[model samples]
Target: MTKPKTQEPVITSTSELPTSEAKWVTLRKVNYTDQTGAARTWEVASRKTRAKSAGVDAVAMGNVILHPARAPATVVVIQYRPPLDAYTVEWPAGLIDEGESAEDAAVREFKEEIGYDCEVTSVSPVQAADPGMSDANMKLVMVEVKLGEEDGEELPVQRLEDGEHIQRVVVPLTELYQRLVEWSEGERKIVAAKLFHFAAGMEFARKEGKKYGL
Candidate 1:
């Protein structure tokens, strides 16, 4: 038996928009000052919102930082997130900061957060982590390398660059997992970052077992 052929999606042109050529009409230029104020509002413009069907929200560039441990019990790590009030425990991550590639940022975060220099071997596609929020986006990457010491001495403390606050610290994979389970603290831990820890830990455990000629 033969089945009917399906039709392909057709592309649309700008002529389909509310207006032929998109343009912003300045409704008013607003600038002012209030009591005890020297300067005030800057110019603003308003534009029609995109159709509800077309509006989409997302979060950008997120990764689970993984630091593989070699023959040691140290869950050693550093962290330097700011305000210290909201208590956000997450892997070194951000909104896919402009001008920086995801792979580049992932490498930089490893250095800044855990002081590890790793290269991105692969990356997952961008996806939303938050449905209720616009720009609730993130991506995961496979950062590869053999772990080593920082400054040839102590484990490097986690630090953030450009005052983009964060703290880095190594923790025992077991301990961290315990905390996550016991306290139900999801905010402090990025979903992707925790996964990275598990992956690295499992790999490390396997390697160590092989080292003992297991």
Candidate 2:
């Protein structure tokens, strides 16, 4: 009797990876008065991805794609995060370029990061990412993609930036929760809050036999 081979896990532990010393973020202090008229100074960090015309933190966009034609799956990316000294599992996301809309940013980032051209279905309102710490805001965009039914499908070409190490992972929607659980138990951890909530919601909807319109 022959044994069947199992597929390797999509997530990988990269805690030992080294990061570049290039300065990608900057910190500054701002003094503001509160409702009680007390003046206080707060430190804030800013990313170089922000556009010059932006007053607040630059607009960022994230995509949640569902492929209905092929094997049911969602697009995700695993990339090294220097701050945590670990690789993070997150959706394809990027900062909106000058003269670009949030929807366009999401579409462009999806292709650049995951190498798939997706059709934007919906865009959410601006949501804060740690208002108490950073002024960064993101608009979650939903897109629908189709991956053909084939064993070992051809991987798409990525257009990553210099110093970026992103690995595209096509996660089956049916096994998202299980994968998350496995990650939690394994060495690598899922630190993206949006990704966690999205997976949880999807699993809940699946259990309740409910269709997520988004």
Candidate 3:
């Protein structure tokens, strides 16, 4: 692949783009089907190619579930995706299926990965992670739940704790900032959604506290 050019902004109004944004090229392996009602699977490579320079050509959804804590705290599940060794901490995120809304996908990922249902409160403007090399960007949305019972839904965790790795743990405001810094430094990566989710949940918890005089 040739060197990717820079400064091709589809549209911008958020934080500084990650260095990786300029270096994520992937291919679309379309599974042709005869049935119109059929489904297909899409896969991305761990490395970039010359063709990926145009854009990332992919999209995904993510969620950060806020649970009840002593203080206004939030939950962050630690999981490790393939291609990136070492169990890096992250939120419940996954690729948007063939036809899935970002918000809806977020909910599905939450349920399957975290085993819960949630409602989206706010969505961040769409942003790119690696822009120059790959057009791949992400639609980040935040969500919450004051109190809800687990529906006891059973979903396949094909990616966590079996062949995959995932660990769910809650983090308070006291430690959030530090982790964000740690993620930024770690080579694996610290997605913006994780940080944004923490901010959004803490905001809601604060408001809830003010109302109850906590």
Q: Could you tally the backbone clashes for each prediction?
A: 25, 0, 9
Report the Cα lDDT for candidate 3: 0.53
Residue 68 in candidate 1, Cα distance off native in Å: 9.7
Better of 1 and 3 by lDDT: 3
Q: Please provide, for model 1 over 41-110, each residue's C-alpha lDDT reduced to its tens digit, 9 standing for 90 to 100.
A: 5544333332233232211222333434433222223233332323344545543444556676677766
Q: What's the true lDDT of residue 94 in model 1?
A: 40
Stretches > 4 Å off in candidate 3: 1-69, 148-162, 180-214
TM-score list, all predictions: 0.45, 0.72, 0.51
Clashes of 2: 0
lDDT of 1 at 34: 67
Candidate 2 lDDT tens digits, 84-125: 656678777777787677777778888888788888888777
Best by TM-score: 2
Q: State which candidate has the highest lDDT.
A: 2
* Candidate 1 ranges with C-alpha deviation above 4 Å: 1-84, 148-153, 157-159, 162-165, 182-214
lDDT tens readout by residue for model 3, 1-214: 6934543123234455444574653454545554686776544443343223322222233343343434444456555443343345666666665456667767777766666567788766667655544345666667674443442223334333334345565555656656666765876555455455655576657667788776
RMSD of each: 21.1, 7.5, 15.4
lDDT preference between candidates 2 and 3, better one: 2
